[model samples]
Target: MARVLIIGASKGIGLETVQRALAAGHTVRAFARTPVRLVGADTSRLEVVKGNALKTEDVEAALDRVDVVIQTLGIGLGDMLGPVQLFSKSTRVLLPAMEAKRVRRLIAVTGFGAGDSKSSISFLQYIPFRLVFGRAYDDKDIQEKLIKASSLDWTIARPGILTNGHRLGTYRVLTEPQDWHNGTISRADVADFLVQQITDRSHVRKTPVLVY
Candidate 1:
């Protein structure tokens, strides 16, 4: 069992990833800005650390001895719509902390428009995303570029439109563009895919687009 650290585990994909890792008998250290209230979270194998990813001290303090680092750190509509600087600041802080701790393996989660797959999304969805979510996506672009340029073993998973549906465990992974359009994937499945890549390492230094 690997000792894993999941940043931004307060809710959503990060929370489910923590549960999945613990169920697989791995020791999981979950970091979040606020306290987590996950059901059936194994206290013995799960350690919750409250800290903001934008703070170097917080990240350094939470970086205990771990085999892999999975970052689900992101800003929602409020922060995303408000300012692009928020995302840049958070990512800037996280990279240095990981380097300082000598943590090599890093897996980060970003949405579809963040990478080369941006042009693959449908026009209907892409219209509003380009207008409203433009800044956020640009910030993600910068963040991804930094990760790609880093000397760490990192893989960025760019999941298509996220839904709260059941985890069918069946999805398509593509490194380059495909002919398919209008893809929707569950957040749970994305988390599962991220955990799988923790040790798989096949797509290291690559950004893969996931769709259901």
Candidate 2:
């Protein structure tokens, strides 16, 4: 099993990924600013590191003795209107840390509507996408670009709008921008795909639009 570092493992998809990664038998280093509580998990294999991703030292410290990096960094919907640099700033620090540590694999959770997927967003969701998530997604575009330009074996999982539903264990991964349609997927399912990518090499260097 690989040692995995999840950058935002406090709540949302990041927390779900922690549960899923543990179940997959991977040694997980859970990084978050808030306290993390995992129910019925083996604490020996899971390391909870409380720190913000924005700090270079914190990010660099978390990469120690890790084989793969899975970043699930997110910002609040309310804070999306303000200056949101979590994704891009975190990536800037993380990429160098991973390089310094010689960790080559990175599976980052950048949602749909980022990068070229804007052309594929549905008309029904277009207005809200712009009015609500425009700024954050713009930074995600920068996040994607930085990851793409890096030397790491990267698979950018661009999941659609996420819900807190049960894991279906089924979803479509659209690689082409034109086929990247907007849809709702469970947080557990997105975590499932991210964990699967830890060992699956098929999606390396590909940004697949994950949806149901």
- Which candidate has the highest TM-score of all? 2
State TM-scores per candidate: 0.93, 0.97
Question: Per-residue alpha-carbon lDDT of model 2 for 81-198, expressed as tens digits?
Answer: 7988889999999999899989999999998888777788878889988899989988999999999999999999998888999999888888877687888899999999999999
RMSD of 2: 1.1
Angstrom error at residue 46, model 2: 0.7
Q: What's model 1's TM-score?
A: 0.93
* Cα RMSDs, all models: 1.6, 1.1
Give the candidate number with the greatest lDDT: 2
lDDT by residue for model 1 (46-77), tens:
88888878888988888769789898876677
What candidate 1 gets wrong by more than 4 Å, as runs, is 179-182
